[model samples]
Target: MRWNAEFMSPSGRVPFIKCGAFVVSELEPIVQFAANKGVTLCSRLSTEEKAEMRAYMSLITNVLVNAELYISWLDEETFNAVTKVRNSSVYPWPLGWLQTRAKRNAVAKRLKALNWHDKTLDQVLADVEQCCNSLSQRLGDRDYFFGTPTELDALVFGHVFTIITTRLPCRKLAETVKQNKSLVALAQRVDEQYFKRP
Candidate 1:
């Protein structure tokens, strides 16, 4: 089935998928970065921390997968809006306004059953730090989980890229990741591999 009128077109899905693929490809680098930085692993996490990590991972994975699937169904206007966000050179007001409105309406309806609320930047950063520390520990010296690409890698990469590359408040995570040589190398490798010009 095609995307709804509110959603963007198949072409719009290209950037979204490309972004996701880039993140998926960077999983190993992030793990390596964590190892070098002495982050704690899942096995080492306190029971509460481990639970939080699992929940955080699950939330991120769901967002990435849903975004991938949702983009596949977008119509023209929705597609254009997403492209505008990615390009950023455009005047972002109308586009951002429209996108935010659409997203709020949709999220409000879809998440009505859940106790959802906006989080402060500090809250988000704290959560991110907690998760990064946990995952980094589990990733010691591993090139990839299960020795290959996995959905977890994709989710982590996507969040890291968006949080790091954008002017969003969460860009500090990118800075933290960069502090580790391994993570920086991994991000560079992924950029060269997926985001480089043909």
Candidate 2:
């Protein structure tokens, strides 16, 4: 299921994982599930460090994710030019139209709840830039958030990579991300070390 993956997800979101007979939705839950299975990344972190990581992760989820949703759904130009077409591409006619409308409405509601629905596109981009700035400060000169690869690195890489590479009607988001050299460097490092492996 390409566009239909959300239908199978317990939370009606994409990027859910199925391990054997069990299903895990969302990144944090999936990471916790993996940790429970002995696949640990932040095991060496101190309790305080772990708490800080969680806070940063929450910031990313609240800021970056909301910004992405706003761009894809709330921005009229992007919604009309990219999101609507891509979202409905896998379906035919009336169902596609129905699904796209529903998804857009759901995203709008979510953003509204987060107080992001009323923000202008410039405001959304500013939020993304501030998010990138915070992440960059945390990272500083370290190659990773904790001086070692962890779930935080993976999470940051996933969002930053998508923002940079994705074709969008508005280039401001990508441009904003690119303005942060440290974050871009971190993304490049992850891409080189992990994704480049054969």
Candidate 3:
């Protein structure tokens, strides 16, 4: 198989997954892969649970992640203070500025298409709070979304941790999770469980 593509891209892609010559690309298939392998990722997903996971992923992708992007790249204070500082640390000027502008524009256009452009920061924060509350209600002090660690937990934790810990200048969105002790604990738990560096 000719895999002639960037191994990764700014679009958040891993070119392929090679598991002993078998390959899957993209996230959903990776979920399917775990199900096929009887792995914990999707092993216990009932029909309803699968549906719920997909729905939550959709909301997270469109709403939670979008809000983070908006707050990070579009908000001037956040962009200049936190986003630019961190991005410029890893990416040189002009390139960093150019890429940040591009990504910010892309996210802005997407949010505009979703009619989120007109939304006030308070409105955005409200949406984030709603999302956190919903997840908390579903999670309810559990170790994971389904009461056990699964790919869904990993997926949500990835975004939440990044958003919360990045120290966004505005801090409203980050505070949404911190204000919710359960959400904060969930991200912390996922980190301790899966991302230990020792």
Candidate 4:
């Protein structure tokens, strides 16, 4: 699995990439393209499984991703302590500070547009709990979301692992994740099987 990977800055946008100068950005189209090309990421997904994967992806993106953004930007303590340093870790001092502030403002505006900026931390975390619970129930006793290992597992991993590992002063979301034992083990299992970097 030799590949080039770039760490795109956190700018309140979706991840995207260039394939031989043909740019593809959004997640759904990228996934469909891969599936159409019989790529490894989606080669094994059946029609039903693909639908399930898309459903889960929507849930995670809408619920977990937004909750993460709200916490990282709107929550005062997390912004000052964790998000600020993490989002700016790559750039040098003054530039890093400026970049972080710009990113914070962008995320704040996006959240406001989504009507999420005004919610209290508790409200946001309550949504996190519901989302996690729904996902956890869907994943009970299974190694992956839709049976065998697939892209859905990978997408789910991104959020659960991120919440667990993020160094936020506010840990409500992480705590909710911990309350679900299956998610913890699912992340650990996937890390061992798919993401080992030795």
Best prediction by TM-score = 2
Which residues of candidate 1, in runs, are more than 4 Å off?
1-59, 62-99, 108-118, 176-185, 193-198
Local accuracy of candidate 3 as per-residue lDDT tens digits, 102-158 = 767877898899888888888989998898888788888788888777767877888
* RMSD of each predicted structure: 11.6, 1.2, 4.1, 3.8
Deviation from native of the Cα of residue 143 in model 1, angstroms: 1.6
Q: lDDT tens digits, residues 88-179, model 4?
A: 77778898899888878878887888888898888888888888888889998898777777777887787788789876788787998789
Q: Give the TM-score of each candidate.
A: 0.46, 0.96, 0.80, 0.83
Cα lDDT tens digits, model 1, 59-97, are 654443333223322323433555435433333667665
Arrange candidates by lDDT, descending: 2, 4, 3, 1
Worst 10 residues of 3 by lDDT: 2-11
Check candidate 3 and list the clashing pairs: none
Better of 1 and 2 by TM-score: 2
Model 2: per-residue lDDT, tens digit, 1-71?
46578888999886799999999999999999999999989999999999999999999999999999998
Give each model's whole-structure lDDT: 0.46, 0.91, 0.76, 0.78
Tell me the lDDT of candidate 1. 0.46
Single out the weakest 10-residue window by summed lDDT for candidate 2: 1-10
Cα lDDT for residue 93, candidate 1 = 64
Candidate 2 backbone collisions, by pair: none
